[model samples]
Target: MTTTTELSELTGDYVLDSAHTRIGFVAGAAMVTKVRGQFDEFEGSAHLDGDDPSQSSAQLTIQAKSIQTRNQRRDDHLRSKVFLDVDNRPTISFISIGVEQVDETNFKGTGDLTIRGVTKQVTVDFELTGTENDPQGRFRVGFHGKATINRKDWGVSWGRGLVSEKVTLEFDVAAIRQP
Candidate 1:
């Protein structure tokens, strides 16, 4: 467990550990079941000003064509123009506009999320899971967050009645501090 003072000592620049992080989403399907998927390729970085949490920031870029949903046909459909349109818009991105510490272990980040060439402001509530020194002697921090947004907001309105418009985005991030 990391204390508040320990968190302040974690201030630094960090690179997301893509191998240990997961960017996933869940959406209702056919109004009866749910569909879960994830993007396999992405890179992100963050600057943590633990002493002044307001100054903390992060940015991420995800390859749109890397979307995986267990089913190849569904994945192909998502890459089509009706959805992500990977050919024209090859990536999805996010840049934090503001960050606020809500408590010792919770934070709220507001950012511009771009998908399918459309940008919209979204807020995600994150909880600091912990911090640890890996076996390789690298210092790492963990955070998990979730945000709900309407698919149509980003022009991803292919399946209407077949798929619920509400989508829940989830993040399980582990960042390693840079030397």
Candidate 2:
């Protein structure tokens, strides 16, 4: 277990442990059920300023072609020009513009999120889950965050009445501290 002081002392650079982290989304389908999908390939880094949270920053890049939703047909369609247009805009990215610590275990991050060549501001609220040292002897930190966005804002206006406009982005992140 890590104490509050220990967490504050953990000021350093870290990389997302992609194998243990999940970047997923949920969107309403046909105004009834919901569709869930996740990106299989992504990389991210963060510079944490525990003592001065405002100085912290993070960036992430996700492969657009890696979108998976259990159904190959739907996945392939998502990558087509009608939706993400993965061939032309192969990656989605985010870069933090500001960060604020709401309390001991909460934080809010505002950043520019680019999807399908469209860039927009997004704010994600995060909760610190915990910290631990894995068997590999690496320091790891966990956080869960989410944000709601409109697909049409990014020009993903294909299945209008079929697919809901609002999509919720979810993140279950595990970051390992660098040496």
Candidate 3:
């Protein structure tokens, strides 16, 4: 397994800290309102080898029902039929096929992101927030990743005029190194 390290540092496996991580999605409804929500139970892992950024990989699993918003009614509607059908897909996931260093704290990686039973290639923009050991000596690392895609491309165009074609997905998943 891989643990946390520097961009120019060594590589290993790190287990995601579900308690400290969040994966959010925001989509525009018409030109007046926006719909926002998040997946509740998500786990992510990254395998980064200092020698080969190309060899690095990432994977994330997000529970659908965890979706939420400022308004409860709207959130319910989104989870119902107008948007994500949690019963059908249940879980949204992203499995990385490749990763490349854009610069320090930045990465441009290509992966297959699945939402609402639709999978498409998406280039993720990620930033690492360094690593630290807890009082128990367990190493934890922070990461923030983002990407945007056309809802129509993935058969997810449920709300046309009410929702924007472009959906922005962001992730703030923190993982710990388990020795």
Candidate 4:
């Protein structure tokens, strides 16, 4: 006789492939200047237990000094004392404790995000885009997550009136399953 195992047993560790992922932010200013940047160095992973969604966990680490706003001059100023101060605080991270499902592919997760040595509770919304087999016969799952954060909340209050107060955070990630 054939038996079925619980969904929770499907949980597995996923290695983040940076080549297929990106973490970025966008903000507008004066209805003309749209500021955008991304972290070039980061590592993230997700542990998902399908049977028991509660068993899922996720974490992300970003290098503060890797932030690039496109303009070298502005990037340098942002790294100065008035801003990120990368020399003193070089890492930003988020660790999730639990996940809440809003729909089949949509879910919200509560976690702690640390930046510039400051930590705060943040909510990340993620969507599952199903899984597929690669040409090598390896299984892979994809997901996209987004969150909004206040730069000042994490002690990054270097923005002037010209810069917006809210920053839109986004992430695109893919994990390949190995047999």
Candidate 5:
């Protein structure tokens, strides 16, 4: 996995290989500790216009019901109206509005993130970790990105004292370029 490839060679449409990717979050719990979890199911796609970094775009959709924190009871509560309300809003999505190249391996994307029907602007900083040709002869690209959001803004404010409002969202994306 070498990230030294020319950006121009990566221009194409790519689909996220969810099995090799992870979308997770971390939040301060009880003002003393942290709770970490991840969504097990998600799909994403990206269009990379290597010639023009600003023309690059990406979109991601995560199943709200797939959140897991290693505890079934807590997971059920999270899927209820108190948190994601997966029954009412089964999906969380992000659509990139703009992208900028901070350098060769660093980039930033500004976009609209929708959670439980509420949409807010957020910026994610991405690191182009690497690109490689896998054993199956498929072209793969890897990226790690992160962003922070306020749960209260998305209508998830039940645990005011138990869980902090700010949450850190992390992405370990593995995408395959379309033939």
Candidate 6:
């Protein structure tokens, strides 16, 4: 089925449907190959304003220890002090400072992203895929977003030669309106 939604009609508080959402990343390795990974645990919420998109906001927190690359050894290394240092810094978070609607289905979210112990401003362009009512009678909105960042800025500078400094993050999110 086809669905369309206007930003003015989406004003509400929503909770991310983590079961259907994905937060993943890609980084070049050895200047030749690319490594992909994802965080398995996260929670987020968003407040959208129909009248003024700039008033909308979102926040997300991800468990650093939950990083998965499909390789046990590599994943373990990433959780070590050389990378995420999950033991000392267990959570990565983002809080949106502002949002701008580019069009009916596109938006730009600017925010501060905290990783390890450092926080940096980043912007993610998001596309509102659609909105639908599930069989369970819940209204859901779906979005896809992406942003690129330098991992070194976040103090994750261990893999100088083995891994690329630039990391691209992707978000596939589905949120349900709060009652």
Compare the candidates by lDDT and give the number of the best one.
5
lDDT of 3 by residue, 50-109 (tens): 677889888888887778777788768767755778777788888998888887667787
At residue 15, candidate 4 shows an lDDT of: 68
**Clash count, candidate 4:** 2
Candidate 6 Cα RMSD (Å): 1.0
Best by TM-score: 5
Model 4: clashing residue pairs? 7-51, 8-51
What tens-digit string does per-residue lDDT give for candidate 5 at 58-134? 99999999999999998999999989989999999999999999999899999999999999999999999999999
Q: Each model's C-alpha lDDT?
A: 0.93, 0.94, 0.78, 0.79, 0.94, 0.92
* CA displacement after TM-score superposition, residue 118 of candidate 1 (Å): 0.7
> What lDDT, from 0 to 1, does candidate 6 have?
0.92
Residue 169 of model 2: what lDDT?
A: 98
- Model 2 poorest ten-residue lDDT run: 1-10
Q: State every prediction's TM-score relative to the real structure.
A: 0.97, 0.97, 0.88, 0.88, 0.98, 0.97
**Which residue runs does candidate 1 get wrong by more than 4 Å?**
1-5
Residue 179, candidate 5: alpha-carbon lDDT: 96
Once fitted onto the true fold, the runs of candidate 5 whose alpha carbons sit more than 4 angstroms away are none
Model 1 worst lDDT window (10 residues): 1-10
- lDDT (tens digit, per residue) of candidate 6 on 5-119: 5667778999999999999999999999999999999999999887898999999999999999999999999999989999999999999999999987889999999999899
Candidate 5 residue pairs in backbone clash: none
C-alpha RMSD (angstroms) for model 5? 0.8
lDDT of candidate 3 at residue 40, scale 0 to 100: 74
